[model samples]
Target: MSGSGIGHDQWKTRFGFMLAAMGSAVGLGNIWRFSYVAGESGGATFLLIYLFFVLIIGIPLLLTEFSIGKAGQMDAVGSFKRLAPNTKWHLTGLMGVIGGILILSFYSVVSGWTLFYLYQYVTGAYWTEPDGGFGAAFEAWTSNPVAPLFWQALFLGLTILIVMRGIKKGIEKANNLLMPALAILLIFMAVYGLTLDGASEGLAFLFTPDWSMLTEPSVYFMALGQAFFSLSIGICGMLTYSSYLKAKDRLPAATVGIGLMDTVFALIAGVMIFTAVFSYGVEPDSGPPLVFIILPSIFEGMPAGHIVGIVFFVLLTMAAFSSALSLLELPVAYVHRTLGLTRKAATLIMGSIIFVLGIAASLGFGVWSHIQINGNNILDMMDNITANVILPLGGLLMAIFVGWYLNRNQAINNSEIESPILQKVWYNIVRFLVPVVMIVILFISLFDI
Candidate 1:
């Protein structure tokens, strides 16, 4: 494989790179997962804490990843090897690659569900409302071993096709198309939700913070985890994406833009979901089933709800697709560069293997439901392992490497922050605060304390 230089694929424009990076950050986490977690954690208070973490922790780590990628100018693993030659820092990159693969395995299963929901809407099948309620319908459909697997395969196939086309033509182009569409869809839905009868209640629930919850330790823990996960920093997806960027790219501006857009998308998604939930008299803290069961049921009862249902699912599928592309691209970049394989060959090989792994995740909701790891079903087991364990560990190691090992001046220069004050602030956070908080998160996730 070639080293970081003119040999690497470069982003065509700064805007394109921003969109692609934002696409990675604003996935199902923003909409599906963000909504439920926010609801469960105490809507307004949780959001406040989440934003705090994003500002202090998320942006610093994001800049760290960007700096690493730009300086190394190679795939995730190659970048580490290039930067810290003869050191084991590359193992962190390897861990990130593994985390990406594991995350996408179960992530694809959920994205497949989004596609299936989209198909149901487009075909007008959702209007019929089966014998059991939407809750029962979702349970039955997900539990059907064959059906979920088919959708999962289809979703993974789409991701593979995009990655195989290479960066400028495949990944960048797809994000350029999908990210704007997702934004428009989200804004439109949020506006529509405002017209509902329960808009007031939904708004209050999402924006009015309860100071009491601020003292809760679990709230802070969940917020920190969400900030890391939502920013897509820990898995080296940002590092891999930034590897394609030119030296002139402004890392700070891109970091802020991506982080702000991601947070706003989550808030808007909360508004859209909670408004519909309240308007339809459904519970706000409905957990994971909030999107699959609660929202669909709400859509069925609203006027012109079928059209809204189509739009909602279409938005969801786009968000999931954009994120999945980045996840798959992480491993694809590593394999293509390290193994000396063509992008097409690498994508196909990695994509096929991930698909096979996702089949087990899909079965977990059905036939494999009986199987549990630490009380989590198959899919949940994968999610917990990656999100809780692998991702936090990876992020922690990255902070340590950047803060303690990387050349301080070179790291600051790579960050592209002009203000000396801000530079010191960022360096210290990544060096000190970030590692401590990440350790706490890792410990909590491991022991479930």
Candidate 2:
């Protein structure tokens, strides 16, 4: 294949396509961020409002992305340029592609954390650990740069391998197995966690509103931001996945499937974490270290800590890989389409370059720990741009493009996506409610509200 462009393959089935899309959207963000934000908000109250924004803002925008991708059968670059006729819409694709680059750099670092745990598990490390070792271990891992970088490259390379296998054998095959397996593992973990003695306190903490926490105006805005971020909105992942969609698939239904799945997983993580922490009479809001610090302690004294530890980390690694592969792919596909590079060439070349870049992100953990412009490290910087800037803007643009630029009926029903009353609801949100909410979110985010 040399420098030649890669071949594009259609999804094997509509179901496979749905799994791939959902797999990307329903990864770490949903599992970790959503419930925490929900807890910070008025819990059930925020959940209701979030449901509104998700269906309206998340689903409609998602449909728009997919519709654009399938309509042009093009990557982000070609899709917009084709639609707007010399307008700047096409450049948004470049923005999305670059955002992927920025995200993957730091993203892999965290994924590396999962990998390190996996290694520890196989070695029976967690099984032999002291009660408080989990926190110290996590500290040792992050406080040093070397370990983060090594595992980050390992994670990124794994992601590239799956993508380079092409869509059918790679994305579709892997997600079909991985997503359901992930769900199953989480459920088992949740059940096991429920049995733990300390799990109830965490549950109470998670479900309790603490309405006093609602005083900050930023809380609501942050809730909306979390909902978007957790669902992988505004990243063009939705758009890119839709690019592979067949016309026969109902765009609305597919989006609903993906959105609901994303929401479900987040809530499940909440329950899983809640049961474990509360059972042990431990508080859950321990922050950042919640996953690394809390879960390992909970599992260590369990009957099969080594087995569960291995399973947990393996599942997390796979989840990270699924999302990262899709992230890397957005740009690789663009490179192939716009620059005419082959899939293998794109994967290997881009993969290698990103692999090296991953080192900088990995180093941010320890040796390069001193590097910071505004007290933000590489991962923090990348997350800020993608979540606060690039993503919201993309979502905002999609709402405008779908609601204003194109004929309403044609733009929406054009995909022939099913879902009756809900579609109308999404239409209304896209037209009025979501835009207003998102505009407020954009403004609030600008000032760090």
* TM agreement with the true structure for every prediction: 0.96, 0.91
Query: Least lDDT summed over 10 consecutive residues: which range in candidate 2?
Result: 1-10
Best by TM-score: 1
Candidate 1 accuracy as lDDT: 0.87
lDDT (tens digit, per residue) of candidate 2 on 1-449: 12212355678899999889888887667655554555445455566556666766777777777877777666777777766777888777888887777777777877888888888888777777655577777877787856677777778778888888878888899999998888889788777767766666656655556666655566666566666676666767667777776666667677778889887777677777767665655554565457777778877767887787787787778777778878888888888776677787888777777777777766765777778768776656666667767787877887777777777776767546556776577667777876798777667656774
Candidate 1 TM-score, C-alpha based: 0.96
Q: What is the C-alpha lDDT of each candidate?
A: 0.87, 0.73
Candidate 2, superposed: residue stretches over 4 Å from native? 1-7, 35-52, 130-132, 373-375, 418-423, 445-448
